[model samples]
Target: MIIVTTRQMQQMDKNTIESFGIPGRVLMENAGRGAIEMLSEHFDLEGARVAVVAGRGNNGGDGFVIGRYLMEMGVSVSFFLLSTRDRVQGDAGANMDLILDLLAEHALSQFIEIPDKDALEAVTEILLDHDLFVDAIFGTGLNADVRGIYRDVIELINDSDKAVFSVDIPSGINADTGAVCGVAIRADATATFAFAKAGHILYPGNFHTGDLEVVDIGIPGHIAKAQSPHIFLPEPHDIAGLIPARAFNAHKGSFGHLLVLAGSPGKTGAAALCANAAMRSGAGLVTLGVPEKLMPVMEPMVVEPMTTALAQTSSGGLDAAALDDIITLLADKAALALGPGMGTDSGTQELIKSILAIASVPMVIDADGLNCIAKNPDILATVKAPVILTPHPGEMARLTGKTTADIQQNRMETARNFAEKQKVILVLKGAQTLVAYPDGAVFICPTGNPGMACGGMGDVLTGMIAAFLAQDLSPESAALAGVYLHGLCGDLLAEDHAFGFSASDMVAGIPQALTTLLS
Candidate 1:
């Protein structure tokens, strides 16, 4: 789905009304009707009682229209106006006029305009008693924080102990940053128009917009395509098309070869997991390279994985002598999964720097591998290889010389900056994993949970990306596809003993997730 910012949506609306010749008022009526239809699809509104909290904007016009429809359909819907009917302007003013005449002719409940301070206080309990609260007090245009009476009223509705259904967007949340503006109404569901707002899919905003329903508000698809928004919420079908199917006559050699430079001594589990995950991720073959001293131990850990012994320091880390052999091996490899169990000893760092200085295949760098590059962040510039750096917040902080808090505060910016400067894709792994392209586009994953915080998670991701690269997917496609599948596996396992499960459990679910795509 196309995820747009407030500016993009407004521009689209303006162009639709002006360029496409769709009347603005016509679009408003369609948006309101579309939202009602969406709500009706999931809910039985035959007798449902609703409260529409309206402001003096187009969003308020949407609320008023929904109220009129609900009332016409034998449902009880009361409109609580933040201001008097005379203050409503433009399309909103026009819509309120129609509603006022309808209420007067039918002797229906007139919209309770907060005439004064006493009236405002009295409406608090009245709003709290409804089955649903419709938030149309604000839309994406709100740039400043809401305060005074508006803030207090928003808080009152939120504390109502009733379910909420926001129109266009929930009031007081910044559409671009997803930051709460003074106060915000936590909607149980939101019906936004045409394009899905970036805030709906982003962290705190997504959290506030429960079960978002993107209503078709008459915006043309070509105009949206023309806008060329950089952000997107990747769906399964989108990535499913990108997953290349094997040719009918395909053999093991046609699948792809993956190289894994991992393992010390005690951390052989990381190497084993990386190699095994590559095989599961559809790699034709996987070669597990370990410190020469740990080869005997690593060999026993693998059954089908090919093994290589790299020269090691006394600490069982890869020595500089290992580079020539690694280059020779990389000649036949399609991609490389680096860092997993690779130690951070000087000799290992030297070996890593050597491989990165020249390795041409796609690379997924993680763990100790990332720390090696942290010593010289600029080394990322010289490496011509297609690189994907999967870093947890601490590792990201190390690479950027910023605090973890700083990175998290503006994750999109931090990841995009690092990736652009380094000329590599960055997968900033956390609660909502952000995969940032060097070109400044960032994708926020809505999947994955706290359970994925365990060890070997990053290792699994490295292997997955390597396997995708081996199959000829571009660096951006590989990272996006890899993280989506990784989180999906976690989401599936979450259904049964998933949260209690470990990183290996997420790895185990990888094949299951592929079946959904492969089929």
Candidate 2:
């Protein structure tokens, strides 16, 4: 599903209204009717009292339409306009007129205009009496911090403990960035028009936007396509479509071989987990390459993956002297998974740079492999086959020289910029893991849960991507399928236990996830 920014959505809406000849009022009606349908699905509206808290904007117009429909259905409704009746203009003003006429006709419904704080206080008790609040104060255009009576009303609705349904987006969220603008309404559900905005899927806004439903508000499909949205939320079908069917008569050589360079003295578990996950993800053969000192440790830890010993530093990290051995290993290899347990010794860092500069196979770099490149990020510009860097916020921060907080705050922009500049596939791993391409397209993985916030999970993901690349999937397909599958594994585990599931447990669930996707 394509995800749009506020600006792109606005342009599409404008093009629909002006170019496609769909009137603004008709769009507002469609939005309102659709929201009512969603509201009925989520809450019992038969005997419920609904408070339609509206601003004097198009969003408020949507609220008026909802109130009018509620009254027609014989549900008790109250229209609380944040501004006086005359202040409403445009299609919203027109809807206000119609709703006012309905208010005079319906005996059970009432219209209250609270343009100031004093007027709001006068009806505070009345506002609290409703069982549900329809929040239509702010829409996708909200950028400034919310204050004054708007903040008070948002706070009141939040404190009401009543079911709150939002229109377009929750009030006080930056529709583009998902940042809370001072305060935001925590809705029970939100009915977004046309398409899901970036705010709806991004961080804090995602938390505020609960059970989101995208309502078709008469925007032409061609108009949306003309805008060329680059961001996407990959559904199950999207990931499933990327995976090729396996041949019935294929052997080990038919699938592809994967070479994984990882491991150090104390972190041999990282190497073992990554190598095991690669085999689990369907790699024909996986060779676990570790420093000579850790060969005994990793060899027994993994049963299926073949283990090899490379020259090691005194510190038990892969030494620069191992470059020739690694190059030999890369020959005829399908893909390379680098950096999971590799320590950041001076020799190990040099060895990583050497491999990165000369290796021809596609590579998925993670853990300390990413840390090694952070020291000389420009090395990414040097000779390289397709490369995918899977970096958590800390590693991403180091690569870009920004704080982790900064990276998290601007994940999409940061990932897109890095991928475009470096001409590589960049996977910014976190809550909604993003896979960004060199062409500036990005895919957001909507799987995984809080249970995935443990060690060795990224190592598992590195192996998955490497396996996919080895299986002849493009770098883009491999990254997308790997990220989605890794998250789906965690989600499967989450169905049984919330947060105690380990990375090994997720690895164990890969076959089940693949079955679920393939079936």
Candidate 3:
């Protein structure tokens, strides 16, 4: 599904109003009604005491509409206005007046105007008595930290422990970055109009926004299409459609051969995991190339893939001198899976440079391979083949020469900028892994869980990407499908239990994950 930023959503709303000739008031009405429909789906309203905590904005106007609907339904709704009634303007003022006119003599008990912090405290106890809350203090336009009466109101609503259904977005959450501004409302659910915002899917904000329901508020399809949203969350069919169909009469060579250069003395397990995962990911054949001395160790560890001993340094990692032999070996390989478990020895690092210069097919570079290239990222420009770099935050920091905190704070931008500059596909691996393309488009993977945080997970992912590439999927398709499948495997394991699944266990779940997609 398309995920828009705050500005993009605003533009979409504006286009709908101006270009499509849809009145802003009609849009507001649609929002209010849509929210009611969403609320009705999740909650029962008969005789319920609902509180509409509203500010003097469009969001507040939406609250007034919801309150009016509830009142008509015989559900008692109290409107606690954060601003003076006169301060509300535009479409919101129209909605507020309608509520006032409809309430008539009942306004004395149903409408309480808490115009400032002093009045806000006076009615805290009364507001807490409601069975449910509708948060409308702020919306997507809010860019700064929330303060004063609004903060107090949000905190009180959260402290009440009542189920909250927010209008547009949760109050005090940054609708663009998903960052919490000061204290924010922890809603049981949110009813956002038009499209899902970045804040709803991104962290902390995602945590604050419990169950999200995106309500269509009469925004024309052309308006949203005109905005050209570049960010998206991949669905099951997305991966399933990209997966190449297997022929009934095909042999092993019909898939493709994958040459994986990995492992060192102590990290042979990493190499074994990568190659084994590649085989599991449907690669026709996998050749594990390791340091000469570690051949005996990895050979028995991985059964399906054939193994080869490459020239090694004294430290037992592949040496730069192995370049000639590697070039010869690559002659028949469909793709190169480089980087997992190859140690950070000087010889191995130099060997990485040589391999990058000579690789002709797509390469999935990870782990020690990424670390070596962070030392000389300029090598990325020299690589002739399409390169996919899988980097966690620390590796990304090293490559960008920025702090890890900066990378995490701006994951989408950092990944997008780097991929565009280097002309490579970047898989920024994390909770919500980002697959950034050279053209500035980004795909976010929502699968996987915290249980997949253990070692060897990236190695498994590296192999999966290579396997997809071997099947002739483009770099983007391969990365998206591989990352999604990798996460799905972990999510499946997480369903049975949490936190103890190993990388090998994840590999075992690959076929099941693929089945889910195909189905």
Candidate 4:
């Protein structure tokens, strides 16, 4: 499932037309038919009126094709042509002519041409008298904020009580960034072509697009794959495929071992959550290394995991002496999950820097461990391991010294840019967690709900990624699978609890969530 930018989508359409020999008109016909099928499934009208607010773009062409099909099916479709009928050129123009020709005798009674705002309002009033509204005013190619007649028409639809089905994408949404250029149509459902546009999944767009249905407009799979869009929307089967099924002869050694350095005195809960999550994520062996002083307190908390007591400072945090023991401990560990309850004490930061200096395996850095790295991020440039940094907006702001507002505003660019610069797998965790790979691909997760907003979520996510990495998943796959699993688990928990659910509860639901997916 590749998510394309507006430009990329247009390029794909152009390539199909020029290189692949698929004419633009043929594609437009298919696009229209595809959207109409989706519309027919949800809306049934033997003689009811359907209002189509059409523009001059291919999106309007799609609406024209749909309107023609509906009219052919014995449904009354009233077309409100925004621009002059003669201005519609190409396949869109042809379709508009065909619709008019079909209703030539009923032109005055069926097709309504509105060239002004007053006429548009009169058309909107007529549309309100109908049962369904088809919004084709604008599409993915819209780059600037809409105004004048078009904006008024979109507002008219929004104010209408009719069920609105947006064709392709809702008008006024920037297809690549999901930024609302101006007033965007709040559609009840959107039937998109081939794949979902990047804007369709991005924040405000996600909320506006009620129910999304991606229709296959008869594009060949190979051609679509050739587009090489750098974004992916993770699916359940995606995670299910990456998680290896255990062989009958598999043993503890078959599953990789994980080494987790976490927990301070008062923050021992973070360590417990991190280590427990690793085991729950199917790590064959997990070694929880904590300050020796907290070992007595942490030992009982983990039933299946083994605990190691390391040197502690007077502050009851991990000390530099633990570095030697950590090196010796890392010999057979397949992956390492650092941070969590690890405090930002000067000595602990030294330990983090020391661990990174020597680590050869993949590592997931989170929580205060990220805080330590933020003080001197250049250390990441020297680490030998494949590092995955999972940072929240605030942590990301500190790591890059950019305001949280900057990070949140352009999450995809911020994370991708930082990941490319730092040469690490960057997981910008927030409402829609973004996974930016070293190769420049990014995935925005769709699973999580508001329930997974409490403490220890990142710790659980850190452990999950390490578990996947230990199992031999590629860095991209591990981050993608981990984020998907983390959110899917949260979504499952959201069912039983209120919107204000806890991250700990979501952690408890991980095994159950995976079990459901596997089954």
The lowest-lDDT stretch of 10 consecutive residues in candidate 3 is 102-111
CA lDDT, candidate 3, residue 129: 91
Residues 77-154 of candidate 4 have per-residue lDDT tens digits of 788888888788988999988987889655423877777888876666676788888988888889899998888888
Looking at model 4, the pairs that clash are none
TM-scores, in order shown?
A: 0.91, 0.96, 0.96, 0.93
Those runs of model 2 whose alpha carbons end farther than 4 Å from true positions after fitting are: none
Q: After aligning candidate 4 to the native by TM-score, how far in Å is the CA of 348 from where it should be?
A: 2.6
Per-residue alpha-carbon lDDT of candidate 3 for residues 409-478, written as tens digits (9 for 90 to 100):
8788899999999999999999899999999888888998999999999999999999999888998999
> Could you give candidate 1's per-residue lDDT for residues 146-201 as a string of tens digits?
97777878888888767788898889888876778888989988899987776777
What is the Cα-based TM-score of model 3? 0.96
Backbone clashes in model 1, listed as residue pairs? none
Better of 2 and 4 by lDDT: 2
Off by over 4 Å in 3: 105-109
- What TM-score, to 2 decimals, does candidate 2 have? 0.96
Q: Count clashing residue pairs per candidate.
A: 0, 0, 0, 0
